[model samples]
Target: MAVKSDFLVIGSGIAGLSFALKAAEAGRVTLVTKMGPEETNTKYAQGGIASVFSDEDDFELHVRDTLEAGAGLCHEDAVRLVVTSGPERVRELIAWGVEFTRSDNAASNGYDLHLEGGHSRKRILHAADITGAAVERAVLAKVAAHPRIKVFDHHMAIDLITRRKLERRRKGKDRCLGAYVYDTKSGDVEVFVAGATLIATGGSGKVYLITSNPDVASGDGVAMAARAGARIANMEFMQFHPTCLFHPPRGKFSDQ
Candidate 1:
């Protein structure tokens, strides 16, 4: 029999963890990952998160900076939405147990903000240099405490289980049912059925031979989605870190 839940989330990165936390409130959530729960691209992120947190900063200014950084490629509406909602999202992170670096001065409102390259103001809230890792650990702890969430680490998602394959109908639009997950340790393939399925796997950064993404960033989600007939777009815009510790011979990154 197929293991089932109300929501099946593939990947245990920040996006996956955050979504699972939200989904668990509504229904049971099954989170699957290809590696250990803590080993993710988020763990390697050394910078801080940017948001409008100071009196000197505002939503419009942040949006302008982001748009300028995007070089006319960013969608105005999406940029506006994220910029306007960033502070609340940061607050949500705080409420979920994320502890950012605190400001020593009483006037800075307790959280210390930094100025990054593109931003015009000091709006970056971080836990020292390991902001992403700190956020991940805190949220993952919350997820672990949530009774409705079940995390399956070392389980790789091979493909999406769409409605056409399971229900025996191939003519209409294919709705996703769940996925076929592989147990990396036991070499067993199993089915995970769910009412809603989400793939929050990080980008295909390792393909460049040198990236900040972890070893699990091998594009499993993109490949699975493409095989499941999802529209693949904007792949040309894949982010590449300009700087990395490049190791010669076979692997570009030292960790790999």
Candidate 2:
């Protein structure tokens, strides 16, 4: 039997939950995660989101920093969209109960911002050192209480279900219908049918032997999307952080 929803969201990271929260306003949403809802790359993120929030900062400066970081491969349109909409998105997060660190400066908005390697201004909006965790906590709380959103933890998506899988006779294009999920606890494969499906399963950090990402970052979403004939881009670019918290035996310090 297939359970149906208006929108199906895979993963529980900042992207997934944030999308689900907004989508729920229009229709019913089914959110699926491989582990507990809180276990995600977003929960492990220490740094903050960058935006032009200071009197000294501007969109051009932020875009220039991002372009430099991308090493000339960045898309100007995408960069412009993010830089322009970042402050409004941050305000939305605050409205959802995310408390960012405050500043004592009288000229500022009272929220403490930090400067990173590529940026020239202190435009990083953070909740102390665990900005992602703070954002995740607040967003997940809203998702849990929303009547239009249903969360399914410990459910792993094996593959995406497309129109080809349904054996439709008159197919104009290959459209995604839903997915086949595996319940880790019950050991059962279930069908989740939806009008639309979203894949926001973070990165493929676990593909490397050692990484700062959580165990759930197994590149499942990327694999599923590729298998479903989606064109993937920028796979050659891999960003590795210089410092990762070392855990004995499992995670050791990397010199690279």
Task: Please state the error at residue 246 of candidate 2 in Å.
Answer: 5.0
In model 2, the worst 10-residue window by lDDT is 247-256
Number of backbone collisions per candidate, in order? 0, 0
- The residue ranges of model 1 lying beyond 4 angstroms of the native Cα positions read 105-107, 165-171, 249-256
Q: Which residue pairs show collisions in model 1? A: none
Q: Estimate, for each residue in 1-256, the C-alpha lDDT of model 2 and write its tens digit.
A: 8889999999999899999999999999999999999999999889998888888888999999999889889999999999999989999999999999989865447789898888989999899999999999999999999999999999999999988656744445788999999999999999999999999999888788668887888899999999887889999888987676655544443311
Query: Which number leads on lDDT?
Result: 2
TM-scores for every candidate against the unseen true structure:
0.93, 0.93
User: Candidate 1 at residue 144, lDDT?
Assistant: 85
State the C-alpha lDDT per candidate. 0.88, 0.90
Cα error of candidate 1 at position 145, Å: 1.6
Q: What is the lDDT of residue 212 in candidate 1?
A: 66
Q: Give a tens-digit lDDT track for model 1, residues 1-256.
A: 5889999999888899999999998999999998889988888778888898887778999999999999989999999999999999999999989999998755456789988998988889999999989999999999888999999999999989887767767578789989999999999999999999999998777677666677778888999999877889888887665775666646444455
